[model samples]
Target chain A: MDKTINQKAWFLVLPVFAVVAFSAILPLMTVVNYSMQDTFGNNQFFWNGVGWFKELLDPSTDLGGRFLASLGRNLLFSAIILAIEVPLGIVVALSMPREGWTVAVCLVILALPLLIPWNVVGTIWQIFGRPDIGLLGYTLNTLGIDYNYVSNEFDAWATVIVMDVWHWTSLVALLCYAGLKSIPDAYYQAAQIDGASRWAVFKAIQLPKMNRVLLIAVLLRFMDSFMIYTEPFVVTGGGPGNSTTFVSIELVKIALGQFDLGKAAALSLVYNLIILIVCWVFYTVMTNAGVERPAKKGGA
Target chain B: MARIDLVDLAHSYGGNAAPPESFALKPVTMTWRQGGAYALLGPSGCGKTTLLNLISGIVTPSRGKILFDGADITPLSTQKRNIAQVFQFPVIYDTMTVGQNLAFPLKNRGVPKAEVDARVKQIADLLDLTPYLGRKATRLTADAKQKISLGRGLVRSDVAAVLFDEPLTVIDPELKWQLRSKLKALHRELDLTMIYVTHDQTEALTFADTVVVMHDGRVVQSGTPAELFDKPAHTFVGYFIGSPGMNIVPAAVSGHEARVDGHTIGLHRNYGVLPAGTKIEIGVRPEFLHVAAPASGLLSAMIERIDDLGRARFARVRVGDEKFSARMPPGFSVPDNMVGLVFDPAHVHVYADSRLVEGVA
Candidate 1:
């Protein structure tokens, strides 16, 4: 039998469509338009038709080489942060106090780093790592460690990586904590009765329970770390022989500093595409291989 | 299999108004015989779960010692106690296959792989879960998952006692009886000294050899199903263990007689004396109240209502200001006025102050 249709439901959906168009779709279309065309100073345009794409894809080209090098750097940064933060976050979440006012206090303290403005966090770290007056730098120098983020490439990379970890690991920890909290008491009791050791309990019960949230943490961390710009931009200003210049910083340099709109638009589109592809791959692979977390709240 | 002995067990969550009376599990000493199936039957919040947890060592008792096979195991953890527990909801390792969940306890104790695999196969076969052993536990239906949980308990050869806390609560109604019978069969085959905790009286009665009926955090009575039905030690047990339970009425007793609303009934045993404010009552099961013709019986009552329960019939009869029900056998037709309900003197359990008077017939 044919069912009745309510075409008027489209009216209810119109505002969301309009909002998305203004917020995302329209700007994206403009970028797409810019990516395939050439423009002069005074409202003059001509079809360049994939010329920038050709240049960006060719590694022999300076633009292509810059993009590739920075992409590698961004990939390495994401890998390192993920390796450090995910396990560290799980440990922190597991050790978190399960009851009392102390949980609230600990949560507030953990959230403090995330609450700070990106630029302010950068500024604070810049001062914090100053060799002359800063406590950390002075202490390190006094201990004969020769630490200077301004001139040393390794120091700059280390400081930037440490800063990002400090700034963002709480998000991972908070996600994991929520997952851990959702596991019912019955599972623990059952595990206890099953004579499970601590490691076995963690492996069998706690880790599987946290799989979905852990996936979320990985995806968010990968996406955010891939496009990271604001904090490193303030702290080292992508300095010390471009040791900390990630792909996002490279895109900004081409678009704003060199005033190369066509190449920059292509770069942005390519960057977005890479993120989308990686996220999709991450999602499918993780869901296929990972433990099934019961979507419905409570019970088997 | 090991006998479980609880010596003066008491648990108080505290933060309550006071102690002893306010405790979640009242102080009591009881022993569960080896190879016997026992049920801790009580209403929700009557501390059945608490008692089960204490036995499993999941929750330490606030006071008292627990012994397994005469060895003090109160201070031991659940692992050392060698107890297996299935929770109200299925507690399965979501990442594991049914086979792996069954093998988990043995593997944890470092049992050899061959033995673990053999035991897993045996339990899976017993639970009719052999075909699905390779499937992920998370994908099974509620009853199947519950069966896998039970299978995990059964797979272990040395479990002191396997405890179930309303393990069938999540099962579908149609499968409930099938799973219950399966559990009973498994119990018989293993003779593992199981203790099943449930609020459903049918579950308690049908599954276990002995039922410990609890009320208000205290064990009101412990007996076989027939004994509990025929001779309840307290009014609470009388009212809790049977269908429609025992009709408990407020009455007064003096000498060898009992009075229900100024109507005197002959008592089977003598009451030599009575204290001034002592309250008394008589409990007779609906099954024991015989419907007789008005003129042939001692008291007459007007019929209030009749329920046709297919093979059996029951009529509600008004006795004085109170209403009492009597069960009629199959094919027994009801009279408009179910005038006389002969309360069986032999079957009636007399209570004074909510407890069985010693020597009550």
Candidate 2:
């Protein structure tokens, strides 16, 4: 049986093509244009011919130096958040009540931090970390520890990390919870009948079942943490000596603060490329470790 | 293998002490002999799963004791009970290889590595899963996955008994018979006491030596397939066991005869006085009902339709307002408008309130 090749199916796909072009492809083209050219007022431009990319990539250059530093900070922040939040989220997901109104209450409370606007989270943490009157800082100072987020680099870094973890760990926990709930009751019953220990059950059954969502949690937390700007910008203002300036804050400092559009656009492209490469790497490794990926629709 | 005895065991899904109607499993006191294959045959929601869970210690009985080989195991967990259960859907460790999946139970019990490998290899070969020993369990087809689950049960030598909760449900139709026969062979080879739960009569009759028929939380009847087909203890059994099961007709009973719609009919043996408040009905299999010319048989009936079923022709005959199916021999001419049903008196079974009444010889 041969399928008749009707070429008209492309018409059905035309709308999606148009939407992607106007919303994404066109704006991306503008970024590419800005990345490769230098403009000096009055809409006049000169071809920089990859000069921006070259400048951005060279750590010796001022633009490249700033970008590399922020990139390192972004990588470090992502690593720390992923390491802290993933395990903590899984623990929280495991301890979560399985049923009843308490489940609803816990879920609502867990979701409250996620629902708060990012900048408000920053504002709240800024006021809460003041050693003068705020409870946390005041308590720490009264204990004679000399805690001050405003003047200490380490305190600023700690405050930003804590704020980020407080704002986002619930998302990971919730994803992991959904994954846990998807495991059928039969698996646990079978494990018990097989006389498997609790650790064995977690290792063989629960963890394997949670792998997909953990992948999601890791990827989302990685990408989001790497791009964090608003909260840290509000609290530490990239802080006590530019200690907490992640790549996004640096990009904004170049693009809007100093109005270096060419350099910023070039940095933005590199940042996006890094994210795409890292996500691709993570996706490949996680999927391969899962034995075989679930077959995609219409896929073999 | 161990002989399992349920001593007045009962289960109710309700959180509180439930009334009789709410009980998922009525108090059942029966023993499944060691080295015998038994089937719990019932419709969906007929408490077959509940019974299987109780046996596997997945669900503790609401009341009474479960004894395995004379030791009370009612207070034990499924782990301590040393039971193996294959769920309705195949439960395999997706992350493990076939050999690893088979070795899971043995390893979990702290069996030595060499013995675990030997057991896994032996069971995998027995189940024809040797070719897939190194392959991941998740990549297998449904039937293969099911075989792996069964292998998990077989890998352990210290298991008290093996319970299957319709393990063949996910298998393909063509592969189901193959898997079922393989399971039966495994049972005999291992000499394991196995209990299979299924609603399909063919699955039950073909796989099990004794089929325990359940209905609405009660064991309506438990017997060999031959006994269930030849003599159903209850009306539900008569209506449930055989393909196109026994035909039951409401009748009024006297000492030596039964009357259907006021027509007097003869019985094989006299049933002594039926008790008051008894609901009388006559059960006779279609195989025993003879079709004859109109007015020459027990009760004249109008022929509704005849279905040709390869070897047998099933004729629908209407007696009074009720329809009954009769198995007709090949070349027996079925009348277009009228026929008579001659029920073999030797096959006549009289039911009083859904229970079979003994014939007084």
Candidate 3:
């Protein structure tokens, strides 16, 4: 039986690998080439020998001095988003009914914002936060609160965070909702028979069951928040003295604004590597949590 | 153990003065003795599960009260009622070990750690799950997982009643017999009040001391296996409880004789006060009837088919325009076209308008 086989099945997977390699590997090679060389006008290039990497890693007399701080901000933003969005999504999912017209209505309404383009979300918030005529800005000023997102770094960061929340919290909520729906009613009945309190039921049954989807939500949200550029870029233009400037925004400044392709390429590679490492860690932890141990004797 | 009483319980999902005729379960009043093993037996959509759920407080009754040990608990939540239930499918914490799954109820009730460990071991030993206690429940086979679910219910000694809703449906055929006997033994050893609900008549009859036969939202009869088999209160119970089921033939009664399919069979006793126009039917179990020579029998039948069932063979025959089954022992030869059926008059039951005619001969 082990020797009997047909090798034709390999044909089925050829197209997928080809498409992935073309899209992922080719661009990655171009980025690697750009990272190691200096390019002047007219497409001329010269070898630089890791000069950009050394400069970026240094702490003084380089724009890369702020790299560590920006990385820290990115991590902080991801953490805050996960803490707020995951719980908020779960709550909203639980509040929806198991069946009925209301469930459909709520789901559709929650999904409407996620379908809009990211750039459009930035523009909408940019206009909406105007102090002179925008509803939020006008309301705040009328309420006698001093608010200027254009000049205040704190206001700019707050506005970007809130905008991101509005645009992406629904994704997390929808995924968690799918996870919640997959749980059988028998578990609930068993929990009831066990005399578990509401908190205990949530902690033991709901949370453990939702571990897989929550991992996906955390990883996706982390990557999205860390690489966030469009909304904050359109709204703040990375302004207010670089206070709200994330790594992506910083990369854009290096490549397009200053036209330093080599340094930008190196920074982009670092950004990709950090995301890859974090995602790998999350996947490993989540997969390990899902592995079930085989039974042994006399332990009960 | 507790004496559970359901007093005039009726439920309706919508607002209506009278429950819709299509109500899943009609009003029912019944009592189960403490430590008695009972089963609710019926086909699908027969409201057996609704009754079980109502008793467990998973569904609150729209009318009347449920009492446990003489105290009203109809309005209480399921957690407050302390009734353990094993569902049709396995329900256990996949993330937890088998021992943890069994100990969850005890831990939730704030039982001491030592007692919880003791109770867990006791149930594991009883269920033959001692060897798999440390293993994660999700990694077990379907039968093993079901055992974990059963143990979870049995581990809690403080539960008022253990309600099993077709818990053996997922078990394999061979293991089903073993588990059924194990459950029966568990009931005797623990003396816990148990209510098992199943559509399978064999499981209900063998496992339960008292079988509550239900049909279409009503309890047709509640009796021991012997009584339910010998004399069923309703026609549905007669058809449902037996292997070949009771053969019901429409007849017209005149004095002490019942004219069935243009042939008359004498009755040992007369049914008095029955109107002449009333619809009557004669019911008899196939085992009580025997095949005989044509002239010596009460009626003649055309043998249609013979089913060879190892120890006994059932002859399906056509008597007049209706078909009836007669049980015959193995090695008995059935004649073609012409066959004779002789039934004891004492074992015959007469029904008028779906209700048994009490005191009828």
**What's model 3's TM-score?**
0.94
Q: What value does DockQ give for candidate 2?
A: 0.38
The interface RMSD for candidate 1 is 7.2
Q: What TM-score do all the candidates reach, one by one?
A: 0.95, 0.93, 0.94
What's the true lDDT of residue B354 in model 1?
Answer: 90
In Å, residue B119's CA in model 1 sits off its true spot by 1.0
Q: Residue by residue across A98-189, what tens digits does model 3's lDDT show?
A: 88898889899999999999999999998899899888888888999877899988888788888888999899889888988899998898
Candidate 1 lDDT by residue in tens digits, A1-300: 999999999999999999999999999999999999877647677789999889888899998999998999999999999999999999999999999999999899899999999999999888888899978777889999999999998888898889988998899999999999999998888888888999999999999989999999999999999999998899888888788899999999998998778889999999999999999999999898765543332211
lDDT of 1: 0.87
* Model 2's TM-score against the true structure: 0.93
Candidate 3 wrongly placed segments (more than 4 Å): A1-22, A61-63, A141-145, A293-300, B14-20
DockQ of each: 0.45, 0.38, 0.60
In model 2, how large is the Cα lDDT of residue A51? 99
Cand. 2 Cα-lDDT: 0.88
When 2 and 3 are scored with TM-score, the better candidate is 3
In DockQ, how does model 1 score against the reference complex? 0.45
Q: Kindly indicate the candidate among 1 and 3 with the higher DockQ.
A: 3
Candidate 3 chain B TM? 0.96
